[model samples]
Target: MSGPSPAPAASDGITPLQQMVASCSGAILTSLFVTPLDVVKIRLQAQENPFPKGKSFVYCNGLMDHICVCENGNTKAWYKAPSHFNGTMDAFVKIVRHEGIKALWSGLPPTLVMAVPATVIYFTCYDQLCAVLRVRMGDWAQEAPLLAGAIARVGSSTMISPLELIRTKLQSQKQSYRELTDCIRAAVQSEGWLSLWRGLGPTLLRDVPFSAMYWYNYEKSKSWLCERYNTKEPTLAVAFISGAVSGSIASTVTLPFDVVKTRRQLELGELQAKNLSYQVSSSTFSVMSRIVAQGGFGGLFAGFLPRLIRVVPACAVMISTYEFGKAFFRKHNQERLRGPLQTRNT
Candidate 1:
């Protein structure tokens, strides 16, 4: 036998209502986790200073930096663990209090639209890549899985990058995008069609390794959970715990890339400049070299702590919620189909 599943795994019999609530909570959680870093990354890309003074809504994460205490030995930025830890709850408060329920769904459309097809592509391509790897290396332990995940993620990221780019711009605004079409038009008219993928380099930079770890760790943990604990086969709690774990691991591997991509996309002239650099790769290298020379590596990972804080829990919540909601909806529909037949027979 495989094993017994856990105590809370039974779920007290999950209801559609609870699942739906959990899902909405989850999405908001991820967005909260990601946005502050999103702001910082974008600003960095735009070539602006990561931390500007004031309570501006655009990037209000001055908490990531240090207060410059008079320590004799040296200066090291302390991780504001408490502040970072509270990001999800804070997001919940902001949404419920300020904008109400509608705000919870703010990034939903784009997320749904972007994530689904990309997932399809990633899985399909990953399976194929793994099949090839199986032939070539027979599940060779070290770097093979990482390479496969990276390759698969690259294709998905390319397709999804445009919508993702628009979503970022849309969410950051006090007024969200008038519509997806309008967002597309505005991005193109101003920045050219290519601008939709402004931060693509960084995205792939983060995704490849992240995807590998996500799948590898998730599969291992889930199998273990199912085997060792009384995990509910299909319940919000399990998904939540699994997703949170997944997000946390993914965040660490992909954070640096997220930082770079944010900076690339945020910078206004970067898209056109990058396009121009295609004709001159050497020139592009020189420009990046100059930026590093000026700012040092810290410029690259600016606001990472805030981002890590925001994203890890948010990811856990959102993904878990989404999956559980989907399961609940499917179950509800099946029950509805059976109810009429039972009533008619009775």
Candidate 2:
């Protein structure tokens, strides 16, 4: 009888740059995709400034408790919709086109600077903690449902908040802050350092679930694809599918958190000083309740439809491109390995 064939080994062709590009490109694509929705979201969020309609949106809302604007197409905020996407694309393309290859990486520096440490800490902390939990819980380990994903997300996200705060403020309006430095100076001079961490609480809450669901779906989908296809190796297509599923799962759990976070950030001037209420119920329920009390529940979900529409394609493209690039690198590495082997054998 023939001996059983040895099992195929997992491919080690993946590179660090491939991994980073795949991950970061997913994020960048997500930003591009949801940008229009982000603009609408921001306008809706900034209405919290307690200002009357038709005035310039500003950083403050302490002048009043709340201000209501009719949800009509004619609203002044409607005109500003182009600012987010237009400005980002404009900035991104210009930076890439003119700034040599390094320009695409300019905005990326702060992002990576923040994201890398956050990711490292998240994975390390969550894994270490979960390992401890598993040892303690014994049979109850499965019950945890990968709970560490959320915690890890928060752990990493904490480091990323300042960069995100700065990026969002800059992206919200192009001309307002001449450059990143200008945005920082203006936000600090006018809004205070707290402005840099705007909506931090809600952001963590959002990220926790977002990360949890992302990891859960990714692992599940990847396993399913591998098993169902009965293949030793799955392609980048599988990765994108898994990523998209994870993104969808994450978005649902964290969306309301995003809504509240946006509102909080836009109204940073008011929430900064007196957060007694914030400390108590920064939980998701309270955030919804407060928005409803001010503008009704419908107001809370105002831009959700557009958000779903924008996110799906953006995420698909983003995830797909990242996976494709990763696959390309994997193929290149495979060729590299085989080339030397073939030459030596010859």
TM-score of 1: 0.50
Residue-level lDDT tens digits of model 1 in 21-108: 5445444445555544443333233232222221112232211110111111112211112122234456455444654544443323
Clashing pairs in 2: none
For candidate 2, write residues 225-257 as lDDT tens digits.
767776544556766677667776667656677
- lDDT for residue 34 in candidate 2, whole number 0-100: 44
Residue 86 displacement in candidate 2 (angstroms)? 20
Model 1 sits at a Cα RMSD from the real structure of: 10.9
Q: Score candidate 1 by lDDT.
A: 0.50
TM-score of each: 0.50, 0.56
Off by over 4 Å in 2: 1-11, 27-152, 167-198, 235-237, 269-286, 294-302
Task: Tell me, by lDDT, which candidate is best.
Answer: 2
Compared with the true structure, the alpha-carbon lDDT of candidate 2 equals: 0.51
